[model samples]
Each structure stands twice: as C-alpha cells, then as structure tokens.
Target: MKKKQQEMQQQQELQQQQQQQELQQQQQELRQRDLQQQEKQQRLFFSSSYFISFAAAVRWLPPLAFGEGKNLTAAAAAAAAAAAAAAVAAAAAAAAAAAAGVAACFFLRKEGEG
Candidate 1:
C-alpha cells in the first residue's frame, strides 16, 4: 500500500510538470505573435518607400484627424508635418506684415507734410 501511494504521487507530480510546460509553451507562442505584430507595425510606420508613395497620393486627402496612436501611420505623420509647415508659413507672413507696417510708418508722409 505504501509503495502504491508513492508511485501515484510521483505520477501526479510528473503530470503537473507536463501541464506547466504546456502552459509555458502557449505563453511563449503568444509572446512571439505579439512581437511579430509590433515589428510589422514599426515597419509599416517607418518605411521610406511607403511614405514616398503615400505622399505622392495624398494631394486630395480631405481634412482629417491624423493624430498619433489613434492614427499612427506614415500618411498621418506627413499630414502633421505639412500642418507644421503651414503654421510656420503663417507665422512668417505675420512677421512680414508687421515689418511692412513698421516700414510704412517710418516712410509714409503725413497729410500736410511732403
């Protein structure tokens, strides 16, 4: 009776170990798949060719969100870059207007002065 009990306990331990290994294998597979997805996303976002092609085609892209995370694509990044460029242009225009105003004040004559 003692020997039988010992053998059964050993079998149970072995079965438990096997189950643990199976669970670990499943977890590893899930981790691998997650890594692959992350790699694919990085590749899609950072590919220069993708950006070049997308840039060539977005002349007609209507107004859009183009925010990060929610819209994390090369096209979205290009849109953001374009917006930044536009903002810089607007600032430069404002500065030029201010400079012209200053110049006019210095150069233009009063109503009675020639």
Candidate 2:
C-alpha cells in the first residue's frame, strides 16, 4: 500500500512540473511577440518620418532647380563649378610649366653634348 501511495505522489509531482514548464514557455512566447510588435511600430514610425522629410524636400526641389525658389542648392552648385574650373586651369598651367622645363633641359643638354 505504501508503494502505491509513493507512485501516485511521484505522478502528481511530474504533472505539476510539466504544467509549470508549459506556463513558462507560454510566457516566453508572449514576451517575444510583444517585443516584435514594438519593433514593428518603431520601424513604421522611422520610415514615416523619413518619407515626410523626403516629400518636403521633393516639393521644393523643382522650384529650386528652376531658379524660382531659394537658391541654396543652385548657389552651392555654381560655387562648386567655379572651384572645379579654377582647379582645372591651375592643373593646365602647371602642366605647361613642366613641359617648358623639360624642353629647356633637353635643349641645354643637346647643346652641351654637341
């Protein structure tokens, strides 16, 4: 009789342990789902904000390009173009000076050798 009672007690303990494990598993799943939902909401908010800013920029882009609105981008582009032109001119001048130096050396060397 004692053996039977001991077996029944063991079975009850096993069932309780299984129930506890199942409850823990469910809680973990719920937590994961909550975290996923929060992440999705954050992503949506970030993209929406970016979209709003992009829309605003596009709204002014055409006017700016056509020179009808603020000349911020246009002025910047003009300045950049001017700087690039100056750089090209300087490079050409340096190249010409280098060629002249090489030619003078060749002529002087030929005169000395001859």
Candidate 3:
C-alpha cells in the first residue's frame, strides 16, 4: 500500500510538471507573435501612405455623412443608439411601476394613497 501511494504521487507530480512546461511554452509563443505584430505595425505606420489617407478620411467622414445619403452606417448607428436609449427608458418605467406597486401594498395601503 505504501509503495502504490508513492507511485501515484510521483505520477501526479510528473503530470503537473508537464502541464507547467506546456503553459510556459504557450505563453512564450504568444509573446513572440505579439512582438512581431507590433514591429510590423510600426514599420507600416512609418512607411505607408495609409496613415495619411486614414487621417484625411477621418477628417472628412463626418461632414460627408451629414451632407450626403445620410451615410448608411452612421444612420444605422444612430438608430441603434436611439433603440438602446428607448430600451433603457422602458426598463426605468417598469422599475418605477414595480416600486409603485410595492409601495401601494405596504406604505400607501396604510394611508389613502392605495
């Protein structure tokens, strides 16, 4: 019984060490990929016309949408924002109604407010 227990403990420790090594390897790989991506982005940002084009596009996008077609994506975003705001209002109204009901049952019932 003592030998069997010792063997089992050794196997568990071995498995744990293997797992730790695998985890360390995975972390190292992720750090390397991230570093490579950062270097690529830095190189592109310094060398490409994309940076200037992006800046000019951003400067013009708002005015273009306001001036023409009512710009599809901006309209969609505005609609989504309005819908979210409405949902918030509806939730607030429901909460107020629930609170009123609870108050009417407890405090308001004692008076004439119920």
| Candidate of highest TM-score | 2
The models' CA-based lDDT, in order, is 0.61, 0.66, 0.62
- Clashing residue pairs for model 3: none
**What are the RMSDs of all candidates, in order?**
28.1, 28.0, 19.8
Sort the predicted structures by lDDT, highest score first.
Answer: 2, 3, 1
TM-score of 3: 0.43
Candidate 2's residue-wise lDDT over 21-65, tens digit each?
998688668757755765575566556655654554555566667
lDDT (10s digit) by residue, model 3, range 5-108: 99999999999999989986886687577557655754564444344434534654675667776575665555565556555655655575576557545743
The segments of candidate 1 whose C-alpha lies over 4 angstroms from its true place after superposition are: 48-114
After best superposition, candidate 1 residue 103: deviation in angstroms?
58
Q: Candidate 3 regions off by >4 Å?
A: 49-114
Best-to-worst TM-score order: 2, 1, 3
- The lDDT leader among the candidates is 2
**TM-score pick, better of 1 and 2:** 2
